[model samples]
Target: MRANRMPPAAMQCRPHTGEALSMAASDARSGRLGFNRLQRRPARDRYDGLARFFHWTFAACIVYASVAGYTLTRLANGPVHHFLSQLNMSIGTVLIVLFPFRAGWKLVRAEPRAMHGVSARQQLLAHGVHGVLYLTMFAVLASGFLMVPNGYTFLGLFEIHTPFQKGPLTDALFAVHRASCALLAGLVVLHVLAVVKHQWIARNDVLRRML
Candidate 1:
């Protein structure tokens, strides 16, 4: 062995050559295994079916109630106005029943992961909007009940008696109800616009998760 030995420079180059061969072999193996296998995208998270159901149901109710509430204010005391008033109240009653379960579900369920490229500010704004929405929703329901001038039939099933008289207190509550409803309407519009921005402009398709 002493008779056949490599020079210092040749020995250094030998190891490098071996390393290069090893790297090439590794690349070849990777190619054989398929590029997609090495570069696969992670699955996107989505809201569960029940959560989607609750979301759409609330959306529809809110839209209808906003329109009806506005119409009630414009129309004079007549059969048409009275019928719409009852219908709006019925929807509000339904929302009151569903709110607890919907809120509880949100508290317990794990939220879907944010889509790729969503900014931190976006997440903050979303949380803030959702919190305000819940607050306004509760306000709308509570004030609706308190501002009722008299006992009324709920869903044509039973009576909802208002202990509070139509005085200063009820009048104040009506103001709160109107303000909360208006705020809620604006928030809903902003929410829809955000979804549209994500789905189309940002190429995020955020609405797909809820769907």
Candidate 2:
């Protein structure tokens, strides 16, 4: 007598059961035994600690410099106003020095991937904004340096004689510097709003990457 056999459909079902058991065993070995792969949370991309530090520090310096610049314009010409002007220039000088290091780090280190679901065009726009911010920052600082008619007294520590002559050229540069600062302020506001939108509206937690 022939041995009993399962129908073709039942035989096919048995292999599926075997496959499920095999997969479970494999998952157990890999430490994901019971979890559904589809339900697993995606991994998050994060900026390195040093990058985060650079970002926050740069932001703080920009904010302080902007506030000081605005305050200087409102104050009457006096010792207090002069001190704030000098402080603002000092902050700009510090940013000029720090920017190179930040750029170098970015060159050497790979940046984290864009947030999940962010389109390529959006990523490009983000990068373009960053490039503009950096360029505007340098332009503002450079023009400010050239605009010092008398000379620059860095934090009242030392006075450096003006390399460029005090003339209409320096006056023009001062105007350019002021305009650049205004542009920078606008860009910073936009940057903050973008982050907020991502964090709250989009629910992407993009701000957490920097933090």
Candidate 3:
């Protein structure tokens, strides 16, 4: 090629031209190149203290309750079986109380930072789904208490009789107890799917908040 008509060096590109213009404008506006002035803000929040505590404790309680429930199902009549069934009922009542505390705390507390590039619509959906989850958790616990035939007692400390005297109320509560469990399971799956999508598909930090 002729010297006057020669193309620019192979290293030159449109992106470089744009970057050079940006830096020049930045320098002119602020008297310095701020390109390297990036700040490392700490990852804001995994969860509030209350939410974290609730998550772990609820996991433990669920494991215990499930085991106790499974054990109760296998035995026909025995001291051990009755005791376990009673213990499970007692623990379920505690969960009924604690679920609300955890959920109410979430309502008042600000959630942790969302993953990078997560849209505002996604964030709003996250919050709305979580609200449904909280309500479902509460309903599950509440119905479980009402479904128990013998009510709940803890180490013989006290007794809280089932409010339903029988008939339709108890039957409905029992149905609700079963239905709420299915709802809760679906919610858990959705929450997990979202995290998997963010991690594997979106390559975001959604799971890092928990980690």
Which residue segments of model 2 deviate by more than 4 Å? Answer: 1-44
**Cα RMSD (Å) per model?**
10.2, 9.6, 13.8
The alpha-carbon deviation from the true structure for residue 97 of candidate 2, after best TM-score superposition, in angstroms, is 1.1
For candidate 2, the per-residue lDDT at 29 reads: 69
Model 3 scores a TM of: 0.67
* Model 1: ten consecutive residues of lowest lDDT: 35-44
Candidate 2 matches the true fold with a TM-score of 0.76
Mind giving the per-residue lDDT tens digits that candidate 3 earns over 66-121? 55665676888888977887787777877877876886787787667667788899
Highest lDDT, which number? 1
lDDT order of candidates, best first? 1, 2, 3
lDDT of 1 by residue, 1-211 (tens): 5598678999899989999999999999989778777566454489988889889999999999998888888999999998898888888888889999999999988688888789899899889899999999999999998898886787678888877878999999999999999899999999989888889999987878998
Q: Which one wins on TM-score?
A: 1
Residue-wise C-alpha lDDT for candidate 2, range 153-187, written one tens digit per residue: 88889986676788899989989999999999999
In order of appearance, the predictions have TM-scores of: 0.77, 0.76, 0.67
Model 3, 35: alpha-carbon shift in Å? 27
lDDT measured at residue 171 in model 1 versus the true structure, 0 to 100? 96
